[model samples]
Structures are given as structure tokens and as C-alpha cells.
Target: MIPAGSGGRNRPIEHASFYAALPLIDDFERLSDTANFTALPEDWLIGVSDIEGSTAEIAKGRYKAVNMVGAAVISAQMNAMDGQPFPFVFGGDGATFAIWPEQARAAADAMRAVQRWALDEYGITLRAALVPVRDIRAAGLRIAVARYRVSDGVDYAMFHGGGASWAEQALKDGIYGFDPAPSGVRPDLTGLSCRWAPQSARNDMILSLVVVPVPGASARLYAQVAAEIVTLAQTLDRGGHPVPRDGPAMQWPPEGVALEARAQRRSGTLLRQRAGILFQTFMAWLLTRTGWTVGGFDARRYNRAVAGNSDFRKWDDGLKMTLDCDNETSKRIEALLAHYHDRGILRYGLHRQDSAIMTCIVPSIMRNDHIHFVDGAAGGYTAAATAMKVQG
Candidate 1:
């Protein structure tokens, strides 16, 4: 007899099966209104990719490069699936995704390729690891999933299980695969970009935060604190939103040409690829400036949507947010969060910065579903991770 969580053609270990099991959320505007997520399939696996010494790299003012490698993980995995939808979240210095066992090998291979590419092309060491859901469950942890439609074509994954957090701990403890990929393998980071300049905070400061439930802490209390943080973020500048509504003005070839060159280094001849990108960027910039009709689509509106709909906050095993707030508001929020920390109910890290940076995956300029990953301009998630380590 086939074992539980087993798959046949109808139950192929793909995202569709998992999504099919979920009740779809048609309301895109009310993301926080969703109910608790359901348990994930035991036959699936969790894939993670993180940069070693990412904090140090960020300190060296290579935060953009760090963000680029992080996004590369998701990009590679998406390519591995050949347009299949899956549950994934992009951390500033890494990324985590749930994949079916059937596609685990492809996912693993893609991660390894990115690892190699990061080391060779950017001198960054990337750690790619995979843990089975069964193992996570055996460790007394669980992973639950929910789908939140962020826009007409974009849906974000909301993970409820602490399994993801436990898996990350396992990887850090050297429990799973942490070795380098074979030589000559390169990650396909198609459409990944760090083109925009750092977004100046309309508020006096932008806050980056990471919050985890402390041992013996009430889950309910932890969730309440998390919700409070989101509520505070909703009262920020720029339409009371965490992300900016206006897109960064794009120069002819964009500001970070070196980053663009590194991203497309694997595409073809470096010079030719760079030139092609420059030409495409010029055309896009011209269209947005002149309000020229491109296939009957509004170029200017698309640019704003890319910024306004970015993935700036996430809740995996822990709660993370990048909030744009004034100094007074930031202090008040910190004091509120500190009360929970003082009570030993949660472990959190908060960093203040003057601006936030974004890395994007624009599969198509016309697509409203493009994803932008945001982080504080200085250290962002790396700083939060550092503070948490100190607390531990």
C-alpha cells in the first residue's frame, strides 16, 4: 500500500496540490484577516539559503550584494519549478521555501548552483540546506501554510509553523547539507535587480525588526505583540504604509551599474549583456517619462506598483517588518516592544536607519506582480540577527 503523503499523478508533489487543499482568499486588500494556516504535507521539504558572515558583508557596505544573493535563492528555485507556484519568503540575507519531495533534487541542485555562483562571482559564501518535513515533525515542530493574495497577480506565502525556525536552527547546528556546490555550476538569477537607489525615508527613520517567541512564552501573547507591531506600522508616513508609493526615479542605465553587471554576468558576453540592459533601461525610462503607451499599458503606473506592492514584511517562524516611522514614533514602539522583551516573553532585534533599500525580480516590466525585497540601508536584517545573537 502507498504510504501516507504519497503522491501519484493527481497528487503530484507540486504547489498546486498544496494550494488546492487550501481555501483560496479572494480578498487581496485584507491580508491580515485570514484565519490560522493549515498544516503542510509531511512529504514536502524545506529549502534554505543564507550568506555566511552576512552582517560583516553588510557592514562593508555591500548590503545590496547581500540582498542580491538572498533574492538569487528564490529566483533559482522559481526557475527550477518552471513557473509553478510555491510557498516562499525572502529574508534580507537569505530565503526559505517549501517544496515537494518530487522536486527536492532540482531545488537542491538550483540552490547549490547559486551557492557556487555567489562565491565565484561576488566572493560571498552561501549556505544551502534542505530538511525534510518528517524530520522537522520528528523534532517536535510543525509547519503550517496560508496564501495571501497581495495584488491581482501576486500572492505571498504566510507560514505558521515553527518548523521553519527549527529547520534554520538545525542548519546552523551543522545538522544538514552545508557544503559547497560542485565547480562550474552557476545559479540562474534571471530578472533579479538592485537597480533603484536607496529609498530615502519620508519619516525621520526606517526601523527594521525581528521578533521571536521566547521559551515558556505564551503563543497568544507573542502573536499579540506581533499584531501590535503591524498595527503601529500602518500608522507610518507615505499613506500610513511601510513601503513607499512612488518608485525611485530610474536613470538611463540605473545607479548601480556594477551590480547590474554582476547579475547578468552569467547571461552571455558581459559587455553585450550590459549594453542590452542599458538599452532596455533607457527605453523603459523614456516610456515612463513621456507617458508613452507600451502595448497599451501604463509604464508610470507599473513602476509605482512595483514599489507600493513590495514584500517589506513577513511572518515565518518569527515576525519581521521594515517600518517607516518618525523618531518619536519609533521610540514609543520600541518601548512597547521592550516591555515584552523585559518580561521574557519574546526575543527581538530592532535597527534604525535613515533609508531602506530594495532588490527586485521584475519578470516582466508590464507584470503588476513583480516582487521587491526591502531592507534597512545600513544593516537591515543582518543587524537584527546580530542583536538577537547578543541576546542569546
Candidate 2:
């Protein structure tokens, strides 16, 4: 007997034999069926994502940037999904997905990847609204689909919303995904987006809420707006920041180049120059060893993506961003925060004080404050495997 939730051609035949009583439909039937009332399975992965702060980003009339971010995220999502029996709706400011229950976690993870891609690539924050199949349905869809019966375990193309056209009418009535207002949180990307917190949010899909368009803005400009939005992305949603120190780092290779030059000139700027190299080295080490892979980052093919300088770090050394930060460090911290501001991670904050690292991938959680990682569970950091005794 074929078990439930099996995929890749082994699903239908097994499901057919198991749930004989529940009318089964073939992939073709499910796809072409004109009926609406389809009894879905216990598991459902309803995924959705939106721009968190678009209004301010688009202030410079950079709609293309917004679309670029959206395109990247959606394309990434499509790749992650790899064709499931669900529907994807590009609802202007945001998107929605209706999928099988088993794929909820996978969908959530994919959505997160998409958001991170937007952040690391275009410096935008994508708010995700993931839910199960059984929760939060458009009344229109419910009314439209309640008439037909569907076969379980069969592949089907079941999408309801698409683009501006489908959502045009619904958007006006405030029924696209969910209401954006009333939460008191205004999005950087305003109009043409919304989200709602579904009531059945806990029944399935690991128990969560639907993160629809809950007041945000979109990327309007592309080139010039890049720096502006980049700063906002960091300031608004960003948290942990890299702490820096004064004087050349303790690990600069070409001591003569920076140090000798500093000694000769007796200038703090020269020492600062050496610090930049150390910072770059640290970033390189972390990228290679750690799992934190940069999206728009390319050392070999380093283009304007990581930096406007496609010409081999031609940009000002001081403008370069540094990560793998420390808090005790001050000068470097200020420099790093300046970099974050330039990248749209930090807003109008003062001198570097804390880490800019975020707590979770979720934008809302990240906005509160610094999500510094601690060693004990009492804090955000990890807990000791087991309690220890005092040496005395």
C-alpha cells in the first residue's frame, strides 16, 4: 500500500487505493475540472510574501527597483516550489500561495530564502505571511470553488489570484490577502498591498499566522534609489551591527603598506586605511567558513551589486561595509554602521553602539531592537548543554 503524502508519481495510485471512499481525481481531472468544491488534504502550505518598507524606498520614484525585488523573490519562490499542486498569486504589492499541507514548512523556508535574497541582493525586507491550506480563504474563492469535488493525491494546478487584473477588483474592497491598516504599522511600500492574520492559523502548518500585505512600500527607483532604500532597509528592519576598533586591526598582512605609510605620514587616515583591509579579510574569512553566503556578493566577478564598483574595489575604502562584528569595538562599529546606513540597513541612528544583526528572518521581530546572540537561553543566545559548577 502506498503511504499518504508521497510525491513524484507514487502519490496518485497509492492515494487512490487508500481513500477509495473519498472521490479521487486525476491530475488532468483536477486541473481541468470546472468544479470548485475540492476536498483538500489535512496538510496545506499557504504561503505569501510582501515588501515591509516600500513607501520610503520608492520616494524617489523608483518603481522599477520595487519590481526588481519582487521579480527576484517570486522567481526564487518558483524555483523552490518546483511545481506543486497549488496556486501562486502575484497580488501587486505581495504574493499568495495555496499548497498541500505537507509542504508548509518547505514553503515557509523557501519564502524566507526569497526574503533573504531580496535583502542581501537589493537590500529590501520581504515580510512573509505563511499559513496552511485550510486557513484564510478569499470569500470570492470560497464561493467560486464550493461547487466542485476534487480527487485527493492527484496533481493539480489550483491557483486563484494572478496579477493586477485579478486583484484589481478585490483590492479595492480590501479582500486581497488581508487588511493592511488597523495594525498601526505602516509599510515602506504602501498601496497595492495588504495582509491578514487568519483565525485557523494554528490548526496546521506548524501553527503560524498569515503574513500578507500588512502596510509596506515598494522599490521604485533602481540606480540612484539603491543607496537610499539600502539605508532604510538596514535602519528599519536591521538590528545587530558589527563592532569596530580604532587603529589598524590586529591582523593586517602588509604591515609596511598601511603601518609603514602611517608611520611615515603620521596620519590616522593611513591607519584607518589598514583597518579597511583587515575588515575585508575578516569578511572573507567568515563568508568562506560560515554558512552566511552573500547573494549579490561576488569577489571574482564583484560588480556594482556588492558595490557600485565593478572595477575591483575602486570605490572608497571607507565606504565598504564590514560584518562578523564585535560590540566592544567602537571605531570599526561606527564605520560598520555607516556602511549599514549606506546599504539601507541602518536608518538615522547615531554613533555605533550595538550589533545590527537581526534576531529572526521575520521583519516584524527584527524591528524591535538588536537581536544579539547570547550564550545562555535566558538571553537570545544559546544555552549551555548542561549547567556547570564553580571552580572554587
Candidate 3:
């Protein structure tokens, strides 16, 4: 949803390059096999992880990308076992394998252990966080197992944690990994359901979430979230933000977002932080006004928040990114739109975490540069429609 050229013909050359010079990372591709994205694992504890700031973290620190990946791999295998006797697999950065659930817990414990090792061992600023399919916990992380069946594949539970993911999002923000995507795809975040708030971004009723669904349990919650998007479109249409609806195909803009099958303003960004930060910031601001601050965030509170925050929490789930996405690729494209917009002037192209062709893009929106827009998104977009303005 671009403003059609922040600097039209009247803009200068450098201003014109503001977008043209925008850095673009490799296209993010998530889920390829025509097989349905399901979960079918037999007595396997799946730990999903990805090297977040491996590039920068390595450059600034001593750890390399491979080191980070290896750490995640080792951690996944450890957590899956949970000290039990079973086999395990570390599916790269976004995932890992475990021999037993007991070993899996060990992996989660290693989150702090590994980071401490990185910091102490190699002078690297790396962190690891793990989760379990059942009974998972970490100091400041969200843990959930998404149970899904992929096409003919058996059921498998994907362990989701927050620290590494948050780091991944951060690394992505340092670059522009999301761009060049058409606004038709919508990815299902239900797989990444159990959520938590970043200690740095905590505010009122909102907690930064990891957001991986319990695999098969995302249907109702997904639908519930979709409802919130509908209401949002109605509100935007009334607010004069050009809700260009194309047709009966995609549910964007409610009426004017999709023009003849083309998305009017492409949206969706890895700027989960941008949206997260913006809204969370507002939450902090609002709650502060009313004496509200994030509580301890019990496990049940975290799970329920992901499933039933209504609009309050549901809205934070990045629902619009799924506007017209009927499959995975399209969803990536739409998500790219968000990835781009949220990046703002300082684009951050963070490729989809699970894409085969991994890449990242982030533009630096200097703090000293944009005074009025400091609280805005990274690139130049803001997903917080109501949060900032609703500060009563």
C-alpha cells in the first residue's frame, strides 16, 4: 500500500532513488511441495529454528552463520530428546530434530546456555530459545508445538520458540529482505501460534508473540482472526485510506484494495517488529496512561492471547498478509508487501524464515532523520492503525 510515490515528479533525484535504491533481498519461498502443509511425525519432537542475526551477529561478534546454524541444529536435536530415548533431526535454522522429548527439553534449556556460550566462548552475540510439543517454558520466550499433517505425510509437531525468531526478525530489519511481492498471497501464521511479548516491547495487554499455531488447531482461530481483518478494512475505508477492492476474489480493502485482480497497495513485511513495535509501543503508551503494564505472562495467558485476543491480540497476528493468499507462494508475495511497507524508508528485506532461497533486506531509518515518524515502521509503513490513535 504505497503512497504512489512519496516523491512524485516534483521530487529530487536522490528522493526518487529513495525507492529505486531500496535494497532487495532474495525472494522468500516458504513450503514448496504441492502436498498440503500438514504435520505427520511419528514419535518425533520437532524443534524449529533459523539463524536470525547470523550475518550481522557474526560480523559484529565472532560467530559465523554456519556456527549459528550449527548451534541451532545442535540445540534442536537436544530439545527434541528431552533426555528421553528417541531419534531427532535439526532441520536447519527454522527447525531441528530430537531423539526424545526429554532431549528436547534439554534443547530449550540450552537456549540460554548456548547464548552464554556464544558470548563467552566466541565473543558472539547469539541467543537460542527452544520449545516443546508439550510442556515447554523459557525465561522470556513463547513455546508451542504446531501439530500438522502435510498431504500424505504423518502428523508432526513443530516446536516454536521466540528468542531466536525475534533475533531473526531483528537481523531481517537490518536489511530489506521483503520486497517485489505482489499483494495477493497470504501466509497462514496459525502454524507459528504460541506467542509471547519481547521484554523490551511489552505493554498493557499486548505481548510480542511468537505466533505458531498448534498445527491442526488453527481453523477456528484463523477464522476468528479473519473476521478482525474485515472489520479493519471497514474502518480504513471510512478513514479515507483508499480501500481499493478489486473483486470477489481477494478480501482486501473490502472494496477498492484489489483493482482488477491487482493489489492497490502491496503490504505485509517481516516488519512483524514494525507492526509489533508500533502497536506494542502504543500499548505501552496507552497502558502507561491508565496504569497498565505487561504482567508476568503465564503460559495459559500466552496461548489464549494467540487464540482469543479477539481484535486486541488477534489483530497483532498479521492477518491482512493473508488477504488473497490461497496457497503458499502467493502468501509469501503478499507477506512481501507487508515486509516492504513496514520496512519504511530504511527498507529491511528479511526473507521468509522457511524459504528455500533465503535472503534479507533492511534499510536504516536513522533515528535522527525522521523525528515525527520515529514511532513509525522501519521501512516507512505502520501496521498500527488503532493503537497509536486510540490512546485515550
TM-score of each: 0.91, 0.30, 0.26
lDDT per residue (tens digit) for residues 347-387 in model 3: 11121111011101001111111000001111101122222
Candidate 2 positional error at 222, Å:
38
Q: Sort the candidates on lDDT, descending order.
A: 1, 2, 3
Worst 10 residues of 3 by lDDT: 367-376
Model 2 per-residue lDDT at 12: 47
| Model 1, CA-based lDDT | 0.76
Taking the tens digit of each residue's C-alpha lDDT, what string does model 1 give over 1-392? 00012233343645456754565554432333325577788888999777888988987989888988898889888766766677888888898898887788788889888888899888999887989999999988878877765556666777765788888778777788656688877777777877776777777887888887786688777777777777776666642345556566566667666676777677577788778778777777888889897777787888778766677777767777777778887887788878989998888888888888888877766666678888888898889878887976
Indicate which candidate wins on TM-score. 1
- What residue runs in model 2 are displaced by over 4 Å at the alpha carbon? 1-42, 83-85, 137-392
Number of the top lDDT candidate: 1
Poorly placed runs, candidate 1 (over 4 Å)? 1-15, 24-35, 238-242
RMSD of each: 4.3, 23.5, 23.7
